[model samples]
Target: MKIIKLNAIDSTNSFLKEMGQNSTLKNFTVVVTNNQEKGRGQVENKWISKPFKNLTFSVFTKDFDLEIKDQKYLNFAISLAIFNTLSNYKTPNLSIKWPNDILSANKKICGILIENNIKGTKITSSIIGIGLNVNQEKFADSLKNATSLKNSTNSKYDYDLDDLLLEIIENLKNTIHLLSLKKYQELETGYLNVLYKKNIPSMFKDRNDVLFMGKIIGISLYGNLQVELEDEIVKEFGLKEISFA
Candidate 1:
């Protein structure tokens, strides 16, 4: 794993994609930023942050030969890595929200955005971007739903940033390798156990912008949200279909 620490960037994913386009940047090449000026998330949602006060980076992965079923496990791996690292704070309350969000209590602590460059059913490469609210204290008015590690711990964690990142990368590497080997049952169990809204009747939006209440049955092998909705209709949702409340 190679880490490229940028002093500043519009978004680490964009930077890494630019790099991947030009060079033979192998899998696991990383582009990180102390401050991301214009970070983005799924559906082009803006990610706001205070400079140098959060964990923001992108991992460039070469996954050309991976089966489509194995691709979503990569998302699981990233969530697991963050969960494990945050566990060092002894906050067992940390959780993986369905479809790639990390939350503490009910507030967002991290967001994972997986973008792929694909040809047919195969992925040529993927940029897994993560923006974790690590050291921030105050959130903007619009981000009242956002919370940081400092908010969870009630005090700052005294840990080296580099060391924590190393831990995450190491876990991530092992996770992808494990999934590539097809040990998916283990991954699914761990992910479901830590899912934030798992088995809870909560609100989610459909493609029509209508809100409905459902319990998360767990994520599927293809990484869709398996939700048991009102009136007992069990539905599955991909990234484009279901949205969180």
Candidate 2:
């Protein structure tokens, strides 16, 4: 539970990973920064946050000895942890967009990026980066789907970032404990229960840019999105292969 607070950093994930490479890092060690100069998202997307107006942090943990095939459960655990934490704040219409984005009323408020250190089919450690838009009211026009806690709740008072971070970390620790106990079914069920757009007919665009209609049935064991097509075929799509249209 060691927390390292920084004024600014290139990326909390990068900083923590580099630190781990050089020395032993206690489990649940966290590195949080007020300004993340080069924060990253899934698939190399940049995580944009106003300085000191958001929660930008990375957590280091090596508590789970998960195999490569069971790694998706870790994703499920982390996503559910954030989902549970935000629910406590009464985040309206909170749901988990597949693979760990936290959405409120279908607009994203939080994003998680997990980097696992693997060796011989086992994940030895994990560096999890989280970016949560807290009090920022304005976003670039380009980020039309982005929203913040202030915008979502219209709260006049700013959220205490430190308190929110600690709450999320506590939830994360509890969820990961379930994983360590191999409660895979419980974790997956919790994740699917809050999954966005589940069982609703929706449009998607594949990497080929071809549009199609499908319903998100569930997620594959390996963390792929399972969509039921019009032809009654259920297909699993990996990241970057399909996106909501």
Candidate 3:
């Protein structure tokens, strides 16, 4: 539970990864920053956040004894943890957008990026990065779907980033414990229970930019999104292959 706080950093995930390679770090070691200069999301997508007005941090853990095939459970566990924590604050319509993004009222609020260190058939360690929009009130014109805790909740509530970070970390630790115990069914059920747009007809765009209608049924064992399309044909899509319309 070692926590390192920095005023600014290029990327918490990068910093922690370097530190872990050079020295032995305790499990659940965390690196948090008030200002992240080059934060990134899944697949090298840039993550932009207002300095001191959001939660941008990374957690380094080597406690999970997971096979390569069971890695998706980590995503399920972390997403559920953030979903559970935000639910306590009464974030309206909280749901986990597939793979790992937190949404409130259908607007993006948090993004998670997980980097796993693999050795042969097992995962040796993981660096989990989270960027949660908190008190920031405005977003760039291009980020029209982005929202923050302050904007999502009533104006009367004062959101503290430090408190929120600690709470999420605690929740994460508990959820991650479930993973270590191999409670795969429980974690998957929890994830699907609050999954966004589940069983509801929605539009999606594939990498080809072709639009289609489908319903998100469940995630595959390997973490691909399973969608039920026209004529009862169910398809599994990877992260880059599909996106919500």
Q: Evaluated with lDDT, which candidate comes out highest?
A: 2
Identify the runs in model 1 with alpha carbons over 4 angstroms from their true place: 156-158, 207-209, 243-245
lDDT of 1 by residue, 1-245 (tens): 79999999999999998887798897789888898999998888888888777888898877546666567776777788788778877653788887778888878988888888777776667788989887788888899999887788887464456776777788778777766676777877888899887888989988889898998997777778899988888898987787776
Candidate 2 lDDT by residue in tens digits, 1-245: 99999999999999999999899999999999999999999999999999999999999988687999999999999999888988888889999998899999999999999999999989999999999999999999988999999889989999999999999999999999999999999999999899999999999999999999999999988889999999999999999999998
Better of 1 and 2 by lDDT: 2
TM-scores, each model vs. reference: 0.90, 0.99, 0.98
- In model 3, the clashing pairs are none
**Model 2 worst lDDT window (10 residues):** 60-69
lDDT at 11, model 1: 93
Give stretches of model 3 more than 4 Å off.
Answer: none
Using TM-score as the measure, what is the rank order of every candidate, best first? 2, 3, 1
List the global CA lDDT of all models.
Answer: 0.81, 0.95, 0.94
Q: Write the per-residue lDDT of candidate 3 for residues 123-211, one digit (tens) a residue.
A: 98899999999999989999999998888886566698889999999999999999999999999999999999999999999999999
